[model samples]
Target chain A: AQTVTQSQPEMSVQEAETVTLSCTYDTSESDYYLFWYKQPPSRQMILVIRQEAYKQQNATENRFSVNFQKAAKSFSLKISDSQLGDAAMYFCASGANSKLTFGKGITLSVRP
Target chain B: NAGVTQTPKFRILKIGQSMTLQCTQDMNHNYMYWYRQDPGMGLKLIYYSVGAGITDKGEVPNGYNVSRSTTEDFPLRLELAAPSQTSVYFCASSQWTSGGPAYNEQFFGPGTRLTVL
Candidate 1:
């Protein structure tokens, strides 16, 4: 069984600043996928970024990027130039065989 | 495209009551999943179907049942509602391929909020 852990329950970032949400997982599979999902008040889950465990390079999408350290079993999400719209609950998930295990989630607050 | 659609955006049921939550996907996806989200807790997989006729239990499958009679529809049934079942349920679908990009990503529905009293 795989488990994802997000140590931070709440995080706040000033507008235009950067914020990083920490995530760690326990999995023995070498070939897997890590993902970060955002859920706003609308309760719609949206994909933020994804990283393949085999890839040494981190994954970056617009202002969202992941610091994936496979050896350390750590995958953290970094949100740059944070805006008010970035206020949401962020989830870290890992998947293999189409099944995903998610962390408890971190509530992000972008303050202006 | 409607993507993934879940009916009855909100519902409240008393103890021992039974209800079915309907889910439909227009993407013609072969894989569908049901998950429940609790406050401060991440989403937990309740059930999943690889195809129309195959269904499997997930981490939290107790008190819930699912059927996938058609490719587009995967409905979850609660035979006897309980307060512990109160949570937001999400329906998701993804195209399955032995090795492909779409296999890793899942499209999710708006979610249905259910309350059991």
Candidate 2:
């Protein structure tokens, strides 16, 4: 079974600063997809970014990007120039064959 | 597009009560899934359907039942609600492809919050 772990339960960053949320996974499959999802207080889940296991280059979407290390089984999300709106619960997920395994998630707080 | 819609955004039920949570997707996606998120916990897959008429168990499938009679609708049924089942439920759908991008990028609906007393 595939499992995802996010060690940090809570994270805080000042506005305009950068923050990184750590994630790690255990999967026997060689090929899979890793993702970061954001859920604000409105309770809507939105995709932040995604990284393919085979890709060496990290995935970036605006201020959101991932440091995906396949060998270490680590996938961390980096939020740059964090804004107040960036405060939310972030989840790391791994997917294959329509099944998605998610980490416990990290609650991010941005202080202005 | 309405994307994926889950009805009854919030629901409260007494123990042993039964209810059905309705989910519909307008994207014409061939894959649908049901997941529950506990407080401070990650979402856990309850059930998934590749397409209409095909449903399968996920990591945590106990106390949950689902039916996919039509491509657009996948309803989850709870025969007897329990306190442990109190959590936020999300419905998601994605396009089906042999492999790669389409299969992994799932669009999620605004979750339904349920509380069992």
Task: Classify candidate 2 by CAPRI docking class.
Answer: medium
Per-residue lDDT tens digits of candidate 2, residues B1-117?
999999999999999999999999999999999999999898999999999999999988999999999999999999889999999999999986776552358999999999999
lDDT of each: 0.94, 0.93
lDDT tens per residue, model 1, A3-70: 99999999999999999999999986656899999999999999999998878999999999999988
Best by lDDT: 1
- Residue B11, candidate 1: how far off, in angstroms? 0.3
* Candidate 1 segments exceeding 4 Å error: B99-103
Which residue runs of candidate 2 sit more than 4 Å off their true CA positions? B99-102
Residue pairs clashing in model 2 are none
| Model 2 TM-score, all chains together | 0.97
TM for candidate 1 is 0.98
lDDT of 1 at A50: 91
